[model samples]
Target: MGLDPQSRVLIVDDFELMRTMLKRALGAFGFTNFTEAADSNVADQLMVEATVTRRPFSLVFLDWNLPGSTGYDLLCKWRGNPRLAELAIIMVTSESDREKVQAALKAGANDYICKPISIDKLKEKLEAVGLGKVRSA
Candidate 1:
């Protein structure tokens, strides 16, 4: 299903600037709801809370390297959990190695985007994950 503008998005990154940039980019793409977490612990907490509240996030932009835990670890954890098995995740990181990309995908990430993300690339990845922009009527 295509993502609605109102879809909830979670951005898990250690850099505040990156999170802000992502939020701005996603906003331009028509998404209105966003939550940012600086590390994996907070991201996991937020995800669980959202799920428990019955308002699970529609998408998650996860950084591969975090302060405490890696995004790959989190992705594996979530993928193993049935409650989060269906959550759409995109790895947003600077790691562009072929093996790393393959590993993330194998771990259940819907897509992967390298750092210095361009608007067009971001749009393409979003669309690939069924989160394409929703045009206003």
Candidate 2:
């Protein structure tokens, strides 16, 4: 289903159920190496504290809504940094705002997907972000 175990991915969502859902969906999509953070603050901390020992998340499925800041804000924060410039981020949220999508792309989101994501669509999204072969259903 996936390419390797060392391909770390991060899911950032403030809501517990949403995070759980994403984790489950990604697992179903054959991504075992994954982690989660509740909000942007925690996500930032996780990125900052990361060392060379552990691989930085190559793929990030970020939630558009968060407690302290919107996902758009987080994208700006992450994208502003040179270290995370090449990171591939996919904004996964319920909000279908076109303006938000435009901003995220400008701010460095590689792609955007709305919530209630299906397994096949998620796999395709991942493939677009540079991952395993995406099988059509």
Candidate 3:
């Protein structure tokens, strides 16, 4: 099934521009709801809030480098947490290193995207993760 247009997605990045970019990219794919975090701290708080509100985020586009903990660190924590274990997390980073990719996968990232990301590539990753292909309007 295609990703729901109302799916609550979270964008976690230290850079405001990157968050904006990802949000815009997702918007093109029919996503309409979003939450953004500038660091791991904010991400954690937001996740908790979402859980309490019973509107948990369905997807997360996470940056590898952040002010506090790294995306890998957050992924590992989430994977270990019962409430967040099922969250679909995509590591969005500039790192193209094979080892880093492997580490993120091991840490439990649902997917990974390199920096300077293209809409097509992002769509492909989403589809690969069963978010469904973006249908052209």
Candidate 4:
């Protein structure tokens, strides 16, 4: 199932490098409608703007640990908001403990990808959880 190229994807990370890497990975996979935020505050703002504008985002790739609010906190915030809770969230982080992954899943991450993400892995995970917004012929 191919995702619509017009659909939106948001990337949240404190490091510009991670954001750039994710953007490159997704772009390599053919996802065109993408947005990035270097911090939790900006990320929250994006979510609010998207929701209030009634243009709910399709996918969000978030870092597990951020400067202030952890990605888990942001996930909780989004999950608490009914309108935003429905959005798909994928956690991208360096932590890969089974317990942490389980906790994130319990907290409502649609899926979680550990640090050093791979293009093929991202594609499979996105598709598995419905972020496959673009595909090759």
Using TM-score as the measure, which candidate wins?
1
Q: How well does candidate 2 match the true structure in TM-score terms?
A: 0.86
lDDT of 2: 0.78
How much does candidate 4 score in TM-score? 0.91
In model 2, residue pairs whose N, Cα or C atoms come closer than 3 Å (at least 3 residues apart or on different chains), thus clashing, are none
User: Judged by lDDT, which candidate is best?
Assistant: 1
Tens-place lDDT digits, model 2, residues 15-131: 888778778877765667878899889888877765344567777888998889878888888888888766789998888888988888888899999878887778878787776
Q: Tens digit of lDDT per residue, candidate 4, span 1-137? A: 23454668899999989888888888776777888898899999999999889887888998988888899999988988888756889998897899989989998888999988887778878787765454642
Which lDDT value does model 1 have at 105?
97
Rank candidates, TM-score, best first: 1, 3, 4, 2
User: Which tens-of-lDDT digit does each residue in 73-95 have in candidate 1?
Assistant: 99999999898866889998897
Report lDDT (Cα) of residue 103, candidate 4: 87
Question: Which ranges in model 2 have alpha carbons more than 4 Å from their true place?
Answer: 1-5, 51-54, 132-137
For candidate 3, give the lDDT.
0.86
Candidate 4 Cα outliers beyond 4 Å, as residue runs: 1-3, 131-134
By lDDT, the better pick of 1 and 4 is 1
Q: Supply the TM-score for candidate 1.
A: 0.94
lDDT of 3 by residue, 1-137 (tens): 34565889999999988988888888888888999999999999998899999998888998999998888898888889898766888998997999999999988898899999788888888887677756542
RMSD of 1: 1.9
lDDT of each: 0.89, 0.78, 0.86, 0.84
